[model samples]
Target: ILDYFELTKVDKEGKMLNIYLQEKNIAPDGHQHQDLESKGFFPEVEIQDFPIRGQKVALCIKRRRWTIKKTGEIISRDWGLIRKGARMTTEFGLFLKGIFG
Candidate 1:
C-alpha cells in the first residue's frame, strides 16, 4: 500500500498535519513498458488518516497519468486506499469502527 505513493511534502497547520503524496509513475498493468509516456497528473485527492499526537492528519494524494504509445490510451493506477463512502483510509475507518461500532 505504501509502495504506490511517494512522500512529496509535509505541512503543519495549527493542530492538523497535511501530508502530500504523489503516486509513482508506473504502468497501470504493473509493468514497466517502454511504450509508456509520462502524462500529467490527475486531480489531487484528500483522505483523512489516523491522528498523531492529538493532531489530525490529512493525506493529499496526487495520482499520476500515463499514455500508452502503442494504443494512446491514458491510464493511471487505481489505488483503493480509501474505503467506500468514507473520506478516511481503510485502516483508519476500520480502527474507528472497531472502537465505536
Candidate 2:
C-alpha cells in the first residue's frame, strides 16, 4: 500500500514517519473498552510523554498482543495516511493526549 500510494521512497528502511510520546493510559469509557475487549486487550498501560516545542504532549502507544508474547511487547503494526486536513493530524494528536495525558 505504501508503494501504491507513494507515501515514502521505495528504498526506505522502515515505515515509521514519526514517533510521539504520551504520559498516561486513558482507557475508553467502560462501554467502549468492553466492545473491543474480545477483539484485543486494552490494558491501562502508561508511558513517558515527549516534550515538543517546550510543551509536554502525549506518549507513543505501543500496541501489543498478549497471545503471542506474554512478556509485554507491541505486536500489531499498521500505517496509513488520511489526506483531508491538517486538522486530522491535530485531532489525532489531541486524541492521543486525551488518552495518555
Question: Per-residue error at 45 for model 2, in Å?
Answer: 2.5
Q: Kindly list the per-residue Cα lDDT of model 2 for residues 1-101, writing each as its tens digit.
A: 22222221112124322343221223333322322221253442223233456543333333323222333333332322322433234456566669999
Residue 30, candidate 2: alpha-carbon lDDT: 35
RMSD in order of candidates: 1.5, 14.6
Clashes of 2: 5
Candidate 2, superposed: residue stretches over 4 Å from native: 1-39, 60-62, 66-101
Which pairs of residues have clashing backbones in candidate 1? Answer: none
Candidate 2: give its CA RMSD in angstroms: 14.6
Q: Which portions of model 1 show Cα errors greater than 4 Å? A: none
Scored by lDDT, the top model is 1
Residue pairs with clashing backbones, model 2: 21-58, 21-59, 22-58, 22-59, 24-100
Q: Can you write out model 1's per-residue Cα lDDT over 4-77, one digit (the tens) per residue? A: 77998999999999999988765676547548987989999999999999999999999889888888888777
